[model samples]
Target: MPKMKRGSEIPHWFPLDVAGTIYPSARTRNWNYTYRSGFLLKEEVNPGLLRQALEDIHSRFPSFFVGVRNGLFWYYLERMENLDIVRRESTYPCRPMNIFSRQSPAIRILYDHRRFCLEIAHCVADGGATLTMAKALLARYLQLTGKEIPPDSGLTDLTEPPKPEELTDSYREFYVKKVGKPAPDANAWQYRPPQVLNYLKVIHGILPLEDVLPAAKARGITLTDYLMAVYLYAFYLAVPKSRRSSRQIKVSVPISLRNFFPTETLRNFSLFTNIGFDPRAKADFSFDDVLEAVKGKLAAAKTKEAMQKLLSSNVAMIQNPLVRLIPNVLKRRVLQIGYVLAGENKFTTPMTNLGRVTLPPGVAEHVEQVEGILGGSAQKRINCAMISDERFLHIYFSGDTKRTEVQREFFRLLAREGIRARVECNIREEEDVE
Candidate 1:
């Protein structure tokens, strides 16, 4: 790989929506995200293959530093332990991508010494950037084996991924406006993942994402409006009832801030709205009604006053350095407090509509598929991640393993509705990376 140009580490910084909800989430989750991408290798990987792959990546994307401050800065301690590069393990850290740490552990490491996988800290790069790293890894591995691996290319080479940030950042301040305050109520059932994996089931299926989107357009609703409506139904069902129309169901959907707001492209570029359902409109609720309501809410949220209110709500609390210095245990307690304040009646689940996936004409020839993963943390119970092309509704989720059954039932619900299904799951195993 060629060396980076002088001062090549310069980055474009943007804000991340999750950064707003600091306390009620795991440090790894609050700040960073870990995800893996791999394939059943055409052949077994030689021990040396991954080490050289990472080394080459570090050389070019070298500024992968951590603990950055002042937005655009990146700080990397140049010692071996500082970055924690593992030759045998294929582990390394760069700068923080999301609020997550830089030198984080690899998610899909050398498990069983056979399965080849890579774990990435979201802080260093968003899913789009990380997928590029995976592509580089594959290209390098192929080259090591003396195959005719093509020259310098990857995910960026695939689709003109509108820096989702570019599209949304222009309206960063308007993020929380569309989200309504939840009406008072008793809380929904909450869940947390355990140390050991024990979910009822982990299943995945693909349908035409386009099909659902058009359904929204038909109703004059946006994709998010439609999906959030689905979650509201799921939330209603998840609850044990005596139907209380007064109960509020809330959801927080991260709004990309690249194009909406003005900012350098270095940091995370996203904002989110904590939207909720008010019972006054609940008794007559149907998906269509919910869709229209969400559209209205979204429109109001994009206004300037909405953004100001969101900023005022948390600005003072976070700016207090003492808030950042509290012991993590205490911090978690405070987070729970804020979470409860948002309303015990917050949405039962989070439906993250990741919009669409744009693919270059023939990239599928190289990669059979690329799935976007959305994992839930303490602040949210369940996450529904959707990525669509013209023909497929690609969906996936990660939550408390115990919720696996719930997810399965949901998938079944989708299938019964007549969507074609193609599934892939690696959750129920003693050895996962394998």
Candidate 2:
């Protein structure tokens, strides 16, 4: 790993990673790409102890505690000093963050009752990195509360000094020139419902792993592949029959580079592969058909070589001399346009599975559950994200539209496969209102 200043000696400002560069420009007046992941503890949260725990682990994850600043030619992260970090839980998850504010921290630490939530801007880090920090914070909080949790359970040791590799930009480090970029994709079919201003409805399905794993194993496919197939099929059922044959339905699956590369950088280091089927081509696509398509695409796209090409393409954009020289003001517009044309427009929705989460033997006993939520955007109005604990997989579907057809169909499909999920939501119907 490349070495750099550690702990208090680390620099206060640095450039955003290859993946981080686009998020700053993609933000609208009301939204940006932010996500939430948190833990449900066995006991109610103690505000004073949670605050103290954050302060204790604050210096360890320096990359996450900084604010976004505009340089003449680019956006960079500047460490915010003496800023308050923790807050009371809001009614909704992944609310738009004010990263433009000088004093705003890069991540939000929120707690409610027994839940400890971390909301992170995509520019600062990806889900994998956020989980690392969450593990550390939870461990420290438990330790402060008189638990004997070991740091070995994927938790960063607060006693040890921070590693330089943890703050490095792994995407740039692993970028390989001369790799051919992947073929372009067509615009995907998206579900559009009337918007609910400033409102986000979150629905969670708690699926038992024992019930779900056998279904995936029986198909000889990974859990992610199975879930992606289910997600796509759900969208397929929701599409109007008239447009089903012509419209292409795609779900973007994010792959963590850490799986293919050797690095521990907590910053964003992942790429997405769009997987779906064209009904025009398949004619009579079945659930099995969707699963086969997802498995095949994932098998080809998840390789190190394919990811290298995607990573190189992203890095090459930032390296362009002309692109780098464009003033920040104009660059933001160009990037936003590029995002619509090359990013969200190409995928119907994103389904990110953070995989199984484990805790120390002692910590495990105190944790009740773990969950993650992918915030919806203007274009991708509904998004899905999930994380699994020892016994159950918690899937959260968050949407800003008034419709729940897609979310309903997703869990319903799982149920048909004999995989029962305990479903819950935050929305109160109009009739329920006083």
Of the candidates shown, which would achieve the greatest lDDT relative to the real structure? 2
Cα lDDT tens digits, model 2, 289-399, are 888777867888889888888999889988999999999999999999999899988888988989999877878899999979987686877889989999999999998
Stretches of model 2 off by over 4 angstroms after superposition: 1-7, 151-154, 243-245, 430-434
lDDT of each: 0.47, 0.86
Where is the poorest 10-residue window by lDDT in model 2?
Answer: 1-10
Model 2 residue 298 lDDT? Answer: 83
Per-residue alpha-carbon lDDT of model 1 for 300-340, expressed as tens digits? 67554555445444444554578757755566656666655
Candidate 1, after superposition: displacement of residue 233 in Å? 1.3
Residue 279 displacement (Å), model 2: 1.3
